[model samples]
Target: MEPLSAEEIRRSFVNSTKSQVKSMALPAKFTELPWESLDFLGWRDAKAPNRGYLVVRRDGGVTGIAVSTQASGAARRFAGLCDLCNTAHHVSDVALFAARRAGTAGREGNTVGMYICADLACSLYIRGLKELDVPQGETAAPEVRADRLTTRLESFVQRVLA
Candidate 1:
C-alpha cells in the first residue's frame, strides 16, 4: 500500500457526502502510519466508535468507504473469523460492520455487512504485527496472506460499490 494524504482519502470516498467526508476523522498519528505494512487503511472514528473507514489503492486510484457497526446483539457467541483476513478472534473482538452501498442503491438504504476485527486491524493481524492469542491456522506465507487479505477486502469494497 502507498502512503495517502488527508485530501486524497477524503476525495476517495464513494458512499459519503462532502459534508460527511469533511467531518470524518483520520486515525491518530495518521502521518506516521506504516504504509508499506498496510493492506488497506482502516480505523474506527476517534470521536464516534460506531463509525469506521476503509481505504484501498486499486489499479491506479484509491477507493474509500465509510461503515458503521450494526446493533450489538448481532455479534456471535463464539470466536469468529474475519472475512477479509481469515483471522480468528474472540467473540468480543469481532463485530459486524456495514457500509451503505454506493450511488442510487445507497440512497435507497441498501447496505453490505461482514464480520471483521473490531479494531479494524486486519492488516496488522495478517502481518503478525499484532499478537493474537490463537493461531490463524493457515499455512500460507505472510506475503500470500497479505495478498489474500487485499483480494477479499477489495471484493467487499466492490460489493459496496455495486
Candidate 2:
C-alpha cells in the first residue's frame, strides 16, 4: 500500500457521493498510519458510529466505499470469523456492514453486506500488530493471509459496484 494524502483519499471514493466524501472523517491518527503495512484502509466514523469506510488499491487505482454497520445478532457465547481477515472474535466484535451499491442501484436502495471486524483493523490483526485470541493450528504466513484479505475485500467491493 502507498501513503495517501487527505485529498487523495477523498478523491478515491467510488461508492460515495460528493457530500459523503466531504463529510467523512479520516482515522484519528491519519498522518501516523503505517501505510506500507496496510492491505487497505478502513475505519469507523468518529462522528457517526454507524458509518464505516474502506479504501483499497485496485488495478493501480483506488476505490472507496461507505458502509453502515448493523448488529449481527450472533449469540454472545459463540465466536464468529471476520469474512475479510478470517480472524475469530466474540460475536459482538464482528458486525454486518452494508454498503449502498454504486450508481442507479444504490439510489434505488440496493446494498451489499459482509461480516467484518468491528474496528475494521483486519490488516493489523493479520500482521499480529493487534492482539486477538486466534484459534490454534492456523499458521499461514502473514503475506498469505493478507492476499486472502485483499481477495475477499475486493470481491465485496465488486459486489457493491456490480
Candidate 3:
C-alpha cells in the first residue's frame, strides 16, 4: 500500500469530533522512518501502556483504529493467510482494533488486528529495525494468504500506532 498524506489522514477524522491524531512515542531509532514503508500512520502512546492507533486512507477517506500490543487470546479459526505474500502467522500475532468506518454506511465497532512481517520494526523481535523473511512464491493456499494478510494488516496497524 502507498503512504498517505497528513492532510488525507486528517480529513479521515472529520466525522468523529471525538477522534484526534495524537503523537506517537516511537523508539528513537525509528524516529527517521521513511514515508514509503507505511500504508498509513501508526503510533503508540507513552501515557498508555500497550496502546496504539492507526490511520488508513482509502477511497478518498481515512479510517482510524485503536490497536493493542497484546493478543486477544483467541485462536484463528480462519483458513487462509495473507494475499500479498504467502506466510502463516501464529494466533498470538493477531488482535482486535476499534474504529469508526467511513462513509454514509459507516459504523463504529471492533475490527481484527494481526501482526505479520513487513519490516515495520515495531515488533519486539525485530527491535524496530530489520525485516523478517516472508516467503516469495505462489505455493501457499489462497485462504492462507488472505488470513496472513489480515494478520499482517493488523500488525502494520499496531506498528503505525506504536
What does candidate 3's lDDT look like per residue over 77-159, in tens digits? Answer: 44333222343344334333333333342334424445432222232222223333333334655445445544666554444
Give the clash count for each candidate: 0, 0, 25
lDDT by residue for model 2 (91-124), tens: 8888999999999999999999999999999999
Give every collision pair in model 2.
Answer: none
| Worst 10-residue lDDT window, candidate 3 | 119-128
Runs of candidate 3 exceeding 4 Å displacement: 1-11, 14-31, 67-87, 100-130, 133-162
- Candidate 1 local lDDT, 40-102, one digit each (tens): 999999888899999999996999999999544554557778888889987778889999999
Relative to the true structure, candidate 1 reaches a TM of 0.93
**CA-only RMSD, every prediction:** 2.0, 1.8, 8.2
